[model samples]
Target: MSCHVLYGIAGSIAAYKAPEIVRQLKKSGYSVTCILTKSAEKFVSRFTLENVSEEKCYTDKEFWREQNIHIHLTRKSDILLMAPVTANTVSKCAHGIADNLLLNCFLSFKGPVIMAPAMHAEMFENVAIQDNISLLKDRGVYIAGPIEGELLSQDLGVGRMIEPETLVECLSVARFPALSLKNKKILISSGGTTESLDPVRVITNKSTGQLGKALSNMAHLYSADVTMISAGDVSSIGFKYQIEKTASGMHDALHHSIKSHDVLVMTAAISDFIPEYSEKKIRRKDNALSVSFKASSDILKSLSEQKKERVFIGCCLADEDTLIETAIQKCKEKNCDYIIANTASNFGNSKRDFTVVSKEKELDSYSGVSVQEMAYRILSLV
Candidate 1:
C-alpha cells in the first residue's frame, strides 16, 4: 500500500511552493492530503493544492465544522510534513498551541514528523525561533532545510525553503530500508580538519560536514548505534558525538573509538599536509612568507590496518574524470571495503553525484541524489 502523507502548510511567502511540493510527492507515489493554516491561505489557494494532490484540503473552518477530523486524519496518515513552516507556526508547535487545524493535527499525529522552515533571515535566526527548532529536533522531528538562497524580500541569506523535488526525495528515501542496521555499531567522522599555521591563523578545506551529518542521521534512523567525530558544530546532531577540530585530534578520537564499532565510515576531510605552527601570531610583511609543510597522519589507512573484523568505508574527492579510478585505488591502498567517490565541485551540496566502489569493482552509482538516499545506499551494502 502507498504511504499517506498529511501535508501541512503554514503562513509564509514560501507557501506558494506548496502545490509543487504536493505534485512532487504524488509523483513519487505518495498519497498526499493538505491542510492550510488561516494565514497560509493568504499566500496559497486551496483549489490549487487540491488539483495537484488530488486529495481533500482542510482549513480552520473545517476544524470547527467537522467532528474528530484531526483525529481521523492522524489515524490514516503515515507521516506529517510541514513545508514552508514559518517562525509563528514553529513557535506554536513548540509551545503545544493548537489554535489552527494544522497545529491540532500535528499535536495528534503519531508517526514520523518532518518540517521545512521558511522565512526571512532575521526571523529565522531569532533566538526564540532557534530555541523552538531545537525543541522540535529533540522530540525527533526531522527538520529539512531553511538553506541559504534568495528570499521573497529580494535578499540572499539562509531562510529560503529547499526545492520541492529535493524535499520529496529526502522524505521518500527516509521511509524505506527501515531499521536495516538495527543493533549494529557504526562510527562516522565528518567536517574539514584544520592545520594551524600560527596562533591566530589556520588552513581548512570547504567541507561543511553536511554529507557526514546526513550519514549520521540516516544511520541513527536505521537504528544503528552511531558515534560521530566532527570538526564542526555538534549542537544540531541528536546522537552521541565528540568534537575534534584538528587532524591529530580526529586521529586520536577515531583510533580510540573504532575498536568497539563494527563499521567505520571516514567522511572527514583530514588535511594531507600540516604547516609548522608558530607560538606567536605571524605579523604581516610586504615580502611573501614561506612556511614548511609536513605530511599529516593517514587516519583511514591506519585505521584500516587495525580493522580486524570491522568494515571500513572511505571517501575520495577528485575531479570527475578520475573520481572512480581514484576511489578504486584508495579502496585497495587504504584496505577499505567500500569507497564513496564524488567530485570536488559537489562539496556541501544538498544533492550530489556519487559512485560507490569496492575493492573488486564498482558497486553502484547515482546522479543528483539527496544525501539521505546516498547514505541509505551505502548502508544497504553493509
Candidate 2:
C-alpha cells in the first residue's frame, strides 16, 4: 500500500521536532507533506521541512487556492496528522473556524485525521479544551496523547507532546489485524431501545451497551467489517468502541438494519413493552397515571427465523432467580450458537456473574470478571 501522510504543525515547544517526525514518516515508507501554521514557523523553519519532505511547505490559504494545492494535497494523502497541536488550533478545528491554510485543509480533507495535542497540564485539563476534544470525537477525529513529562517552563506534569518515534510506532501498530475475517461482514446491535410513550418521552431499559461495544471493537480488531447499529445516548467503555452513529434520527435500529452481516451479535437489552397509544405531549398528571402496555417487536426472533448461514449470539438477563435454565431456554428458543445470560439488577453496574449456554453442554459458571473480560470470553466461543 502506498501511504501518504500530511503533517500539520501547531505552536508548541515540541514544534522543533517536526523535522524528525517527517524523517520518521519517510523511514516508515510514507510520502510526507508538511503544513505549518504561523506560530509553528517560529520553532521549525519551512526550509528544513521542504528539504526533509522534498515537497512545498504551505502556510498560506491564498497560496492553496492560488495553485489548488490543498485539494490536490488532501487527495494525495491517505492520512492527515496534527502533531504538537496547540490548544488554539484544536479549538479552531473543533469549531470549524479555519482561518489559516492548515486549518482549512483539516476542514476540507476527507481522509483519516489523527491529532496529538501538546500543552501545559493545566491548559490540557481545562474544561473548554476537554469539550473541544469531545467535539472532535463526536465528529470522528482520532487523537493521540499529550503525554506526561517536564514542561517548557521547567514544571512537571502531563501535556508534553509524544515523541516522533512514539507517534510512528502508534501509527504502525495496526489498530485492526490483517484480514482475520477477510470476507466476513458483521452486524452488531447495541444500546437500549426506547419504547415511545409520547413524542418527547419514552420507556427505555438500563442497558449501557458496554458488552456490545466491546464485541464490535474486538471484531474490528480481528479485521472484520463491522457495523454497530443503535449506539446513540450510550457511552462506550473502551478504544474499541468506535462505530459510526446511525441511530440518531430513528428508533428501532435493529429491525431496520438487521439484514446485512455474516455474524450477528444481539447484546442490546431491548425494552420488552411499550405504550399502545403514545401522546404527542407529556401526559398531564394530578395524582396517579397509567398507560396501556404491549409487547414491542422481537428483533432477535425475526433474525433467527430468517437466518441463512449467519452466526447469531443472543443475550438473556435474569434478576435474582433462574439464571442457567432461562439462558439455556433462550438459546433453544432463539436458535443461537450461544446465550449470555446474567443478572439484570447488577449487570453493567458491577462485575457480573454469567454462564455460557450452548446446545451440547452448559458451561461452568464464571463470576467476578469485568464486562470487558466477559465480552472477550464470549468472542472466544466464536
Candidate 3:
C-alpha cells in the first residue's frame, strides 16, 4: 500500500492553490487526507479538497462532531504537510495552540512535518514569525519554502508559497527522518564536465544534473553539511558550491573539498576523453578535420588512494550486459565503499533503475524509483 499523507491548509491568499497540492500528492501515488482551517475555507471549499484528494476533508466542524479525530488522523498518517501555512498557523503550531482541528493535528502528529509558509512579505519577515520558524526548525520540522515571488497584493517578495508541484516534491523527499546526518559533512559533485577543443567548441554529455540536485536537497533535508561542485547552474540550490566546467577543474575542487567531508558522492559525468586544446576556433575548410583525444584522469581512483576514514560512493554507467559486473569491478578498483550502477538511458530521467554494489557483493537494486527516494536509500547505507 502507498503511504498516507495528512495535508493541512491554513488561511492565506494562497489557499486557492491547496486543491492542486492535494491533486499532486494523489498523482504521486500518495493517499491524501486534507484538513482546512476556517479561515482557509474563505478561499477554498472543503468540497473542492475532497473532490481532488478523493477522501473526506476534515474541518473544525468535524473536530467537535468526531471523538479523538486528531489522534486517529495522526495515527493513520505517514506524513503531515502544511502547504500555504500562514504566519498565524506557524505561530500557533510553534506555540502549541490547538483550538482548530489543523492545529490539533499538528500538535498530535509525531511523524515528519513539512510546512510551506505563504503570506505578505512583511508578515513573513517579522521577527516574531522568524523566531517561530526557527523554533519549529530546531524541533525537527522541515520547512519547505517561502520563496520569493508574487504575493496577494501583487507585490513581489519572499512570502509566496512554492508551487504545488515543488511542494509535493519536497514532501516526497522530506518523508525521511529529520537529522539523519546530524554531525556528518558530505561533498558532492554534479553535472557533466565540459572539455574544450577550441575557444567555442567543447565536448559534453547529456547529464542534466537533476539527480545530483535531488541528492543535494536530500542531504540538506537530513541536516548534513553539504558542499557541491557543479558544472551547471545550481542557483536554485541554497548551498555552498563552486563551479567547475572541466574535468581537471572538478578533480581539483573535489580534492580541495573532500578533506573536511565524511562522505563523497561523485555524480558528475566527467568527460572520458579530452581533445588537444585549440586557442582559436577551428576553421571549417575542405580538408577533413581530425582531432586527437586523451583519456581524462580517474578522479575517484586517485581520491580513494588517499581515503582514510571517509566513505566514497561512486556512480557508473554501463551496458545492461555488464552493468552489475562493471559496478562490482569499479567498487573494488576505485576502493569505493559503494557503487551505484545504471545505464545511459537514466542519464536525464527523473525515475531511474539502479543497482548498488559494494566491494564484497551486490547490496540492493531498485527499478523506476524517484531520484529523491534513491538518494534516501543511498544515504541509508552510509
Candidate 4:
C-alpha cells in the first residue's frame, strides 16, 4: 500500500486499458505515476491517465528535461509496471534501445519490473519477440498474460491484454521484498524419466510433471533464477534445460547441474532400472523375448559430499506404511536438508498427501487437491 509504482504504457490498441490498471493499483494504496510513450498517446489521452493515477503523467518530452526525470523516476519507484507492452517496445527494451523516457528509466531501474504484453497474434508469435521475452525473463522480469481472447482485430489467438484484475493479482505476487529470493539459483529436476527398450518403445511412469512445473513457476514468483532439468513438460523461465531420455541419462544430467545451484529440488520420477538396449528394432524372436535389467546410478547419493552447504530437497514415493521412515532415511542417505514423501498411490493423481521431514526428523504433513499447497511448502523451506 505504501509502495510507489512506475507504470509505463506503450503504443498498442490495448493502451486504452492502462487507466484501469493505474486506478486499481492506486486504490490498493500504491502511489501510481504513468509514463506514456509517443505512440501510446494516440490510444490513451494523457489527461485521462493523470486523472486516474492522481499524479502527473510523463512523456518523451520529459526525457531531455534538465531535472533528470528518468533517473529520478527510476530510483523513486519500488516497482516498474509496464502494461500493453507493444512488440516494438519489447524488442527495443530487449536490445537496449532506450530511445524513449519509459525505456530510459526501465534500463536504469534497479527494482522489480512486471511486463504485460499486447499486440497482434503474429507479432507476438514472431521468433524475435519470443526471444526478447526470454531475455527479459532471464533478467528476472515477471511477465503476465497476453491471454488468448478477442483481439481488437476481431481475430483471436494469444495476443490480448491480460485483464486489469489479473494484472493486479500478478503485481501483488511481485511485491514481497521479505520473501524475495533475489540472488539465489534454484535447480529442479522433474517429470517421469523414460528408459528405452528400442527406438519404437519406451518405459515410463504416469507422472506428468505438474508438480515440478508448478514449483518452477512458484520459484520464479519469488524472484529466484529457476532452471528446470526434466524429461517431460518443463517451462523455460530461466536459461537452462536438460532433457534426458533414460535413467542413466537423467542421473548424468542432474549430477552435471548440482554444483551451480544454491538449492536443488529433485522431484524427478527417474526410472530405477533400464533394460539392455538394442541397437536395432528388437523384433519378437519366436514370440519369446527375454530382457535383462540393471539398476540406474543414484543421482542424490553421489552428491552427498558436495551438498554440505547447499540445500538439497528430495522426494520419495513409498508404500503407505513405510512413507515416513523411508523419507527420513532418504534425507540421511542423500544428505538432503529436507525430504518429502507420499504414498505411491498419489504419484499420478491430482490430489496428493505429502509427509515432510527435515534433518532426519519428521516435520508436518501437507494434503491438497491442488499443487499450490506443495509449491508453498517447498518455498517455505527455501
Global lDDT of each model?
A: 0.85, 0.72, 0.86, 0.81
C-alpha-based local distance difference test score of model 4: 0.81
TM-score of each: 0.63, 0.51, 0.79, 0.61
What would the TM-score be for candidate 2 when compared with the true structure?
Answer: 0.51
Candidate 3's residue-wise lDDT over 175-290, tens digit each? 56544675678888999999988999888999998877777777766657788899998733234688999999998999999988999999999998999999989998788878
Q: Residues 1-382, candidate 1: write the lDDT tens digits.
A: 6899999999888899899999889887899999999999999999999988888999999999999899999999998999989998899999999888899999999888888899898998899999998788667677776777788757997788877876775575447535457678999999999888998999999998877777776776455788999999853223578999999999999999998899999889999999999999998788778889999999999888788888898999888888888899999999999999988877878788999999888888899987777777777767
- State candidate 1's TM-score: 0.63
Ranking of models by lDDT = 3, 1, 4, 2
Candidate 3, residue 150: the lDDT equals 74
lDDT of 2 by residue, 97-195 (tens): 977888878987987677888999999999999999878855656666666677977999778877787576445323332224535677777777666
Badly placed stretches (over 4 Å) of model 4 are 1-114, 117-178, 285-288
lDDT-best of 2 and 3: 3
**Cα shift from native, residue 145, model 1 (Å):** 17
Tens digit of lDDT per residue, candidate 4, span 89-185? 8898888898989989889999888898998889889999999988887777787757677897579878888778657656655544435576789
Q: Candidate 4, clashing residue pairs? A: none
Q: What does each candidate score in C-alpha RMSD?
A: 9.1, 15.7, 4.0, 9.6
Model 4 Cα displacement at 120 (Å)? 14
